[model samples]
Target chain A: AQSVSQHNHHVILSEAASLELGCNYSYGGTVNLFWYVQYPGQHLQLLLKYFSGDPLVKGIKGFEAEFIKSKFSFNLRKPSVQWSDTAEYFCAVANSGYSTLTFGKGTMLLVSP
Target chain B: DVKVTQSSRYLVKRTGEKVFLECVQDMDHENMFWYRQDPGLGLRLIYFSYDVKMKEKGDIPEGYSVSREKKERFSLILESASTNQTSMYLCASSLFVRTGRFGQPQHFGDGTRLSIL
Candidate 1:
C-alpha cells in the first residue's frame, strides 16, 4: 500500500513571498508523484507530475517540485507567490505498475495581496 | 485538451435512496476513476475502470458501487445513501499508454457536490 503525507495543513504568505509545501510518500518500489491544485469553486487541475527523469520537475503557473528519492519527498516550490496563487494543493502518489493514486490530506495556502 | 464531464454540479438526495452519479469523458481514454473529496481529507479513490465493463476497487470502496457500461462513461452508485456519503465527487480519465519510462496523467472533471440528507 502507498500513502502520501503533507506536513503543512495551512499556509499564509504575502505577495512576492517564496513558497514551499512539504510532501512525502511511503512506497518501497518505484512510484509516480503528482501535485494538484484546486482554486476556489474550480476543479482540481494538475500542477505537475514526476514519473522518471531529472529529479527536479517543472509545472504550470511557475510552480516546480523536486523528487528527493532518498528522503521520499517531493516538495512543491515557487520563487514568489501572488494573490492568485491562493488555492488548495494536494500531493498524490501512484505505484509505477498501478494506475490508482493515493492522495494526501491537502494543504490550504492563502496569499495576501 | 481532454474534457471530463460530470452529469451534475450539485445534487441532493435523501438517506437510503439509491443515488446514481454519471460521468463522461470526451477523449477516448482507456482509464476512468471515481473519487470522493472531503474537507481535510483530499481526494479518496472509490473505484476505477481500466477498460469497458472492467472495474477495480480502490483505497475506499465500501458503501459504494460503480458501473462502467461504456468506455467513455462511468457511473458511481450509492445503493443506500447516507449522510456520511455527502461530499464532492470527482471523475477523472487517463490514457493507459505505457511508453517506456513515461506515464500518463489524469484529467478531472468539475466535480459533483452531492449531498445525502
Candidate 2:
C-alpha cells in the first residue's frame, strides 16, 4: 500500500507570494503522482499529474510540480500566488495497475489580499 | 463539459436508518468512484465501480456498499447510518487510461453533505 504525506497542515501567504507545498510518498515501486486542489465551496480538481516523463510538469493556473523519484517527493510550486489560489491541496499516489488513489491529509492554504 | 451530478447538496438522516446517495455522470466513463471527505482526512475512497454490476471495495468500505445498475449511474448505500458517517460525499468519473490523462479530467459533483442525527 502506498501512503502520501503533506507536511504542512496550514499555510498562510500574502498575495503575490511564492508558494511551495511539500509532498512525499512512501512507495518503492513505480507509482503515479497527482496534485489536486479544492477551492472554497468547490469539489476536488486535478492541478497536475505525473506518470512517466520529465520530472517537472506544468499545470493549469501557472502551477508546476517536480517529481523527484530519488527523494520520493513531488512538490508543487508557483512563483506567484493570487488570492484565488487559496484552497486545500492534496497529494495522491497510485501504484501501477491500481486505479484507486490514496490521498494524504490535505494542506489548507489561505491567501490574504 | 463532463458533468458529474450528485442527488443532493445537503441531506439529513437519522441513525439506524437506511440512506442512499446517488450520482449520475453525463460522460460515458467506464469508472465511477464514491469518496467521503472530512476535515484533515482529505478524500477517502469508499467504493468504486469499473463497469455495470462490477463493484470494488476501496480503502474504507466496511460500512459502505455501492450499486451500479447502469454505466452512467452509481449509488452509495449505507445500510444503517451512523454518526461517524456524517461527512461530505463526492462522486467522480474517469476514463480507463494507463497514463490517466487520456480523457478529460475527473469531473466532480458539488457533493452531498450528509448529517446523521
Candidate 3:
C-alpha cells in the first residue's frame, strides 16, 4: 500500500531558526506531493505542491519543498522561522491518475519568540 | 475564494445516537471528501464523492456512511456514534482532473469538533 511518512512528530525552534521537515512516500510510480499547514483555530491551507516540473517548488509565506524522486522524499524547508509560523504541517501524496490524497502524520512546530 | 463550509464548529452527542454532519461547497467542485483528524493520525479519509449520488469508501470508512444528493452538498452519517468517534471532522472539495494529471488542490473548511459522551 502507498503511504506517507513524516519523521518529525514535534519540533521546537527559536525565531529565525532554519526549518526542515522530513517527508517520504512509499509509492514508486508517478505521484503528486503537497504540503499543508494548519494554524491554531484555523483550517488547513496549501503550502505548496509538486507536479511534473522543476523539482523545487515555492509556496506562500516563504516556504518551499524539494521533491527528490530518487530518495522518494519531498521535504519542506524555510530559511527563517517566525512566531506566527508555529503550526502543524502535513505532507501528502497522491498517485498519478487519482484524486485521493494519502497524508502522513503531521509535524507540530512551535516557534518560540 | 473557494469556500467549504461545515455545518457545525462543535458537536456533542450520546453514544448509539445517529449523527449527521453536513458539508457544503460554494465552488461547485466535482469532488467532496470527509476526513477525521485525530492526534497522531493526521487525517484519515472516511468517504468521498465524485459526483451527485456517487460515493466511494476511503481508507477509514468502516463506521461511516456518506450521501451526496446534490453537487454542492456532501453529508457524512454516523449510524451509531461511539465515544471513540470523538474527533475533529473535516470536509473538503476539489476539482477533478483527467487521468495522469494533477487535480486541483483541495480546499478545507473549519473542521467540526465532534465529541461523543
Q: What is the lDDT of residue A96 in candidate 3?
A: 78
Question: Per model, how many backbone clashes are there?
Answer: 0, 0, 0
B1-117 per-residue lDDT for model 3 (tens digits): 999999999999999999999999998899999999999999999999899999999999987899999999999999999999999999999998876645468999999999999
Candidate 3 lDDT, tens digit per residue, A1-113?
A: 78999999999999999999999999888888899999999999999999879999999999999999999999999999999999999999988777889999999999999
TM-score of chain B of each: 0.95, 0.93, 0.96
True contacts kept of each: 0.46, 0.38, 0.62
Local error of candidate 3 at residue A21 (angstroms): 0.3
Q: Candidate 2, residues A37-59: lDDT per residue as tens digits?
A: 99999988899998788999999
Docking class of 2: acceptable
Stretches off by above 4 angstroms in model 3 are B101-103
TM-score of each: 0.96, 0.95, 0.98
Runs with alpha carbons beyond 4 Å of true place in candidate 1: B98-103
Please, what are the lDDT tens digits per residue for candidate 2 over residues B3-115? 99999999999999999999999989988999999998888889988789999999899788999999999999999999999999999998867553333346678899999
> Which of the two candidates, 1 or 3, achieves a greater DockQ against the reference?
3
DockQ of each: 0.55, 0.43, 0.71
How does residue B50 of candidate 2 score in lDDT? 79
